[model samples]
Target: MDVKRISGLGRNAAGDLAKGVRQVGPGGQVIVVRPANSNFTLQEYQNFVNNFKPQQPGVTFRVVDEAALPK
Candidate 1:
């Protein structure tokens, strides 16, 4: 499985992400890593999930907190 690291999320980015996910087919995994202090709001997060969910119903999505990562 090829891993892709995206800097952040936006309309175009999300679209591209969805497209990539579709290309990967089902069982694909998408791990989103947030910054140490992220400014993304709850609604935005929900929207992000909503956007990708329909595109790839079988894909797995995970959010990783950067601060929680071992330095």
Candidate 2:
């Protein structure tokens, strides 16, 4: 699977998300890996995904907590 990884989410996250979506192209996945100490909340991440869904169809946007990743 084609994946675009992004570290943390901030005020300028949308731009990065857009770039990631474009980089991965259609049907690709953009994974935003949030750091443990990130100031952004899960709700914010979800909001970003929700907002982008309509704008970019076929592109998968996901936010994963860094702590949840397998070591």
Candidate 3:
């Protein structure tokens, strides 16, 4: 399956999510990676989904929470 990987949390994570949706379209899956204590809000993540358009039937988003990733 074609997958879009988003690394980081909060604003950074959302940015990646937006990029994924834009580049991969609504037919692919999105993977968001984030730190444990980035103090990010769920709304940030939802914001990405809200802006995503042309929803495809098989489209999906997967978030990976991983801290200590190199910036």
Candidate 4:
């Protein structure tokens, strides 16, 4: 499976999400990497989903905490 990895979503989370959707298209997986104490919030994450759902249906989106990942 192809994964579209996005790291460090500071102020441009939405834009990055759009890019990911475009890159992966439909039926693709998106892995978002953010810090445990990141500025990104769940509301924003949901907004990304709500905005892109119509354009890219059946896309899987997952957010991963960089600080929690095992090395």
Candidate 5:
């Protein structure tokens, strides 16, 4: 299965960023790593993940929130 990439930006902005893994596959794992915010909520995260779609069914899609690397 081809791997998909989702980029989560903005620190402490999970509301706008959306905080959860999207389209996770059976074997793949979605990794979220926003700037550890004390006020990050789960609902917003859910919204983020919900907006994503798997390119193909049973493809085992996964997400990863990484530290915004320097440009």
Candidate 6:
């Protein structure tokens, strides 16, 4: 599976970016970087994940704090 990292983007923008990536038809994980000032809400994130579930069963998307990423 492919792994993608998306940072510095709001909810809508991040969703757009993820959708673009999904067009490639690769099932993978999308890691959204959640900063202190991020406007990405938990509900929005869940909706984003759920929205793609029906279309692409292999795709998995989630949000995480920037610090949680491995060096």
Pairs in steric clash, model 3: none
CA lDDT of every candidate: 0.61, 0.69, 0.54, 0.61, 0.38, 0.55
- Per-residue lDDT of candidate 3, residues 3-42 (tens digit): 4444334465555566666666657777655445656544
Off by over 4 Å in 5: 1-27, 38-40, 59-71
Candidate 4 local lDDT, residue 66: 66
Quick one: best TM-score, which candidate?
A: 2
- Best of the two (3, 4) by TM-score: 4
Model 5: lDDT of residue 45 = 46
Once superposed on the true structure, which residue ranges of model 4 sit more than 4 Å away at CA? 1-11, 40-54
* Clash statistics: count for each candidate: 0, 0, 0, 0, 2, 0
Tell me, by lDDT, which candidate is best: 2
Ranking by TM-score: 2, 4, 1, 3, 6, 5
For residues 1-71, write the lDDT of model 1, one tens digit per residue. Answer: 32344445787657656766776778777665556555774345546755665365678766566666679
List where candidate 3 sits over 4 angstroms from the true fold. Answer: 1-13, 41-58, 67-71
Question: Residue 36 CA error for candidate 1 (Å)?
Answer: 1.4
**Clashes (candidate 2):** 0
Model 5, span 1-71: residue lDDT tens: 22323334334333322222234434444444434342444444445555644343443323333334343
Q: Model 4, 1-71: lDDT tens per residue?
A: 23334444444666677677778889877776655565666556545545554257777777655676888
Identify the superior model by lDDT, candidate 4 or candidate 6. Answer: 4
| Residue 38 local lDDT, model 5 | 22
Sort by lDDT, top down from the best: 2, 4, 1, 6, 3, 5
Write model 2 residue lDDT over 1-71, tens digit each, in one string: 23434455544666777787777877878887767786777777777666764245688877778788899
Model 1 local distance difference test score:
0.61
